[model samples]
Target: MSRLRIHRFAFLGDARPFGDREVIAEPREALEPRVRLGERPTDGLQAERHFAADEIGDGHGQAGIERRRGGRVHGGASISAHARARPGRAQKSAIPDNPRRKRGGIVEVPFRLRFAFAMNLSLYVVTVLIWGTTWIAIKWQLGSVPPPVSIAWRFWLAAAAMFVLLRAMRRPILPPRDAWRFLVAQGFALFCLNFLCFYYSEQVVPSGLVAVVFSTAPLLNSINGRLFMGRPLRQSAIAGALLGLAGIGCLFWQQMAGHVDDRATWIGLAIALAGTMCFSAGNLLSSRMQAMGLHPLATNGWAMLIGATILTAGSIAAGLPLAPDTSPRYLAALVYLAVPGSVIGFTAYLTLVGRIGPERAAYCTVLFPIVALAVSTVFEGYRWSPVAVAGLMLVVAGNLVAFDLTRRFFVRTA
Candidate 1:
């Protein structure tokens, strides 16, 4: 007399595709104590398949008794190994979570973050440090190599590194033919043009200035989402955008001061704006690709290869220099971009875009600058001006408005 409860399983990252699974467990107490804290399995089958005893704290309880007692099966359930292999397969019988009825071995987890703020904070800091310093790294490579050439070489190296890593793990390198064009477009917009604009703009403006300007990416993305996809535009979105824009204006005004006539600075800033536009465009493109069921990591790898080809072609056409002295700083920066910045950052960002959609994820651009500012403070001894402080405050306020963080505050307070 087993009560069948169908369970579905979903994976967090691109390592696995989205698939449903079914598991028969007692309708009542089938999943109680065995579900781990913060473990979000799609269904009971997934829980049984992925969760370990150590991972799930309590013993598996009986059906009707626990169903009537514990209120609901909010957490903990284990899926059988057989259930995971053929996700489409129908369940034969109820999978119990009883400690006394333990059967198979535990699945090994690759990495565990425990959903701690400190863990997230650390990851955020690492991401920003890698990104912020890359600005200076990018600046250093400017005269030594042509912009497009540098980008081509950087991505070639990145592609190579990613290839080796993926291949070592025996991950498939080949993707469908249709995926190539989309990957190339993404790479060009995301890696090539995005970097080119930023680098060239830096030639005209300070890195800090370029960063401050790029912070508007989220606002642009929000607008793009609304116009392109017909997503509902919230008032908070408009307010948030305006607040962020006003903050940028403050920074611009402060920087311009009596030097507003500086043509080069203005030009550079304009280019920076253009680069941000490209970044926003890439976000939209990636969103489309995700919808098509392409994994971000695989797509990014292929796109980098495509971007590398396009950039190299451009470099050849322009007779740009391709070589840079393989100094420690240069190599280090390149590796950082290849791994943490390009690989890790793109993966995180794209996945986030897939989950929350591009608009909300663009918030990372805003926060990333704060990370950059902190790095600037340490490495370059950057100090805030009174006006800069005001601008920072405005930026924070604007971000709150744009993302509707204010709503969260009110909700919590209420």
Candidate 2:
């Protein structure tokens, strides 16, 4: 009698999604791991389903395995794979880990902390750096074009490129029908109104003041997350956010000084606040979409398309010319903003929000000023003052606190 071995599997049916499960079975090996649909009927016990490996790791994607008794299935001992196409490819069984698997007697870092943190950090850095530098490009996009029209052009190009990229990768471009309503809300808030408010606000207020207001995003996200999503208010995240806000204010203190009593200044501040709220709302929407199994690329692509259309319509109604600026500076900035700033930046950012929680991820807004100032220093003659240097340290401190990075290295592992 040949013995059957269980390779990869997940528990099917109900609340247990894929964390810590034990199936009682000398599971069959001929059952391909990747083929997720398998029902093992028991003698009056609940029907059990198995999957090979899935996204939660050890395999790939989401899957589950239910506990069985004496390693037997219903009235039968085993079953074959359900036909999900594999053209002439042999299935490879993974090696089982040794009970005492150890690396030189040193425990390894937890995958949740180790792998997830590293990837999230990379995404976070890319998002901050790309968006930060885009301010300069946005400045280039300003003259000879209405800011709204320029923004419309940026998103049109961004959405087009994003769809092309998604098609090349064979990822789904359309979200579920249920998702479009939220997609519209997200497109309006994040892509359309957010940019419009910011562009207009910057005209009235000092850019630094606008940035200072924008830095409040993490706090607002935290509050909204707790109220709407029921996510807990983390002390460390709040502390970090407050610290980052202070750092940002210090960093831009000089530039931020202006006629605060001016009516236009107050209006600009109000507009900046509205834009920040829109941004926070978008963050929440992205989280919700991810929970719905919608990828950031898909959501952003759709949202960008919707946003561009809306902006273009509004610009047309406002009597702005829908002409393109073909100057080298304008074209270069448009390309950079469309691809790197909008596409890459938003995807990386929203993905981070899904992984790290919105509050912690919104801390990226705080870091934006640091990168923007650095770029400004190089290209626009920005001089760093002692206050600014102190501000930089505070911002760094805030990120450390926000991420809670220290505990991972010193984590007590078994």
> TM-scores for all candidates?
0.68, 0.76
lDDT tens per residue, model 2, 201-288 = 9888998899899999999998998898766687778988999999998998987776677999999999999999999999989878
Give the lowest summed-lDDT range of ten residues in model 1. Answer: 57-66
Please list the Cα RMSD from the true structure of every candidate, rounded to 1 decimal place.
10.1, 9.5
Cα lDDT of model 1 by residue, 164-257, tens digit: 7778867667777776777777888888888888888877776557766887887788788778765556566567666666665565455546
Candidate 1 Cα misplacement greater than 4 A, ranges? 1-129, 248-253, 412-414
Reference-based lDDT, residue 63, model 2? 24
Candidate 1 TM-score, true structure as reference: 0.68
The C-alpha local distance difference test score for the whole of candidate 1 amounts to 0.59
